[model samples]
Target: MSYQDRRSPDPLRRRRRTTPRQRALLELLKRDNHFRSAQQWHAELRTTVGVGLTSVYRILHQFAEQHVVETQRAEDGELLYRLRDTAEHYHNLLCRICGRAERFTLDALEHHTEHVARQYRYADVNHHLDLYGTCPDCAGVAQQE
Candidate 1:
């Protein structure tokens, strides 16, 4: 099927236009909090949805462009993807090994950002916080080896 044909025909639909495969992928990501690679997503999807790897990669890139998901680079330089949180702003501590993430909010950081922006007379400022490191579980496992 062609890309244009995958879009919703209904003009009244309020949500962003997405293909059936894209919707399925979003649902899967909604249930999983950890970042996962396109290969992993495609592997899981194949068991039920039978989507092609190219389709998975295309849909993931589209989702990322639409701000429906976030992307990060792993230590090995592979790209990882996960659904974005609904909160206005937050930080994520990502595990380098497992792609697990811990979400956090800090008032001081927000205040500091605002203070700095105001000092510099900046307007329409935005930020994305993603701190990457080994989570405690991964750290423990590494220490054991």
Candidate 2:
């Protein structure tokens, strides 16, 4: 049999019973560029997708558990979620002034982490790095003054 035929059907797909709220949440995440908090998502869903706040939160948690989405703490300490599939890699650059976030590849950062791990004789080491700086807009404003 072909690979498609040999593989079992997706459980969620087979049910034809997936929640509309969950689908709507996925759709919203797919369209947005930045990560958003549960409250922000709920507001957007209510205005655009007609989904309720409770349903949005429930679906977000489900998505987070499945690794379909990722959560991060914003500068103000609010939890935000973004679709994982759309992210090429996961490293953050934080703007000190405006508190905006930018995601970039982690190649150089990973290399440094590996070097540190080897120096420390670590069996395995994983690290998260967030670089903080004034973003271009903020830097430009600073320069103008």
Candidate 3:
């Protein structure tokens, strides 16, 4: 009930501003165009920001749903995320260790899928195709080891 108590900020509480955190997470993503698990992103963010792990997962989920980021499954089935390179539908050749990606499109595959869908009378058919390998830089590093 003291007059000065209400005017002072709460020292024990950590402020969590939504927009800044979201933008900070985004800035982190922009630093590299490489896919990583949410846990990985959170661990990296911890060194630079005060974002919580739950917030990291939630923000990444929101970005995925909005198509602000692209996601793919790693070899062990963990979901990986990266900033989307384009608005169009496409696939990528991903590097398993380094997360490097090269976006690609296959017209023959698309046509074959469409034909198969029509043959089976399936509507709204879609597909996901990704190739995983080691990029040259990672391979060279491995060779040196």
Candidate 4:
């Protein structure tokens, strides 16, 4: 059978049935732990997979929703995608220059949030923490100036 014929008939409806292009994108993201924009990924994959930009975006969005990929905003405000390593709640220390991420959990912060919520009688509380800064390498580069 042709490669296209083997792809899922309806990617939007079937979560389990992914197109070959989507599978390729997932594999690429899995191999690359660093964050990349949809445009970057599309540019890289076009030469090898012949996938379109819209397909790249659709697949990335679906992966993000399924928790297979994590999304973060760059310094320029463009959304970037990376492979998710775990399902546990955590925060990220992201590098503004190279898009490196260090995941960490703050138990004290969580406790404080819960305490404050209880004091305010709030329910269904959740939080998202993202700390962005230059990494040591980036800082060193800046220092040399």
Top-TM-score structure, candidate number: 3
Model 2 over residues 11-79: C-alpha lDDT tens digits? 333434557777877778878746678988898888767777788788878876555666766667776
Candidate 4: tens digits of C-alpha lDDT, residues 1-145: 0001122333233468788998788778867887889998898778779888998999888887766677887767799998765555777788987778887788898899889899999987676677899888878865545
Cα-based lDDT for every prediction: 0.73, 0.66, 0.76, 0.76
Sort all candidates by lDDT, best to worst: 3, 4, 1, 2
Candidate 2: stretches off by over 4 Å: 1-17, 48-52, 86-88, 94-101, 132-145
In terms of lDDT, the poorest run of 10 residues in model 4 is 1-10
Model 1 — which ten-residue stretch has the worst lDDT? 1-10
List, residue by residue over 66-141, the lDDT tens digit for candidate 1: 5667776666768888886542456677898778977777788778978989999998766666678988787886
Measured with C-alpha atoms, the lDDT of residue 87 in candidate 3 is 54
Candidate 1 deviant stretches above 4 angstroms:
1-13, 16-18, 73-78, 140-145
Please estimate how well model 3 matches the true structure, expressed as its whole-model Cα lDDT: 0.76
Candidate 2 vs 3: which has more lDDT: 3
Residue 25 lDDT in model 1? 89
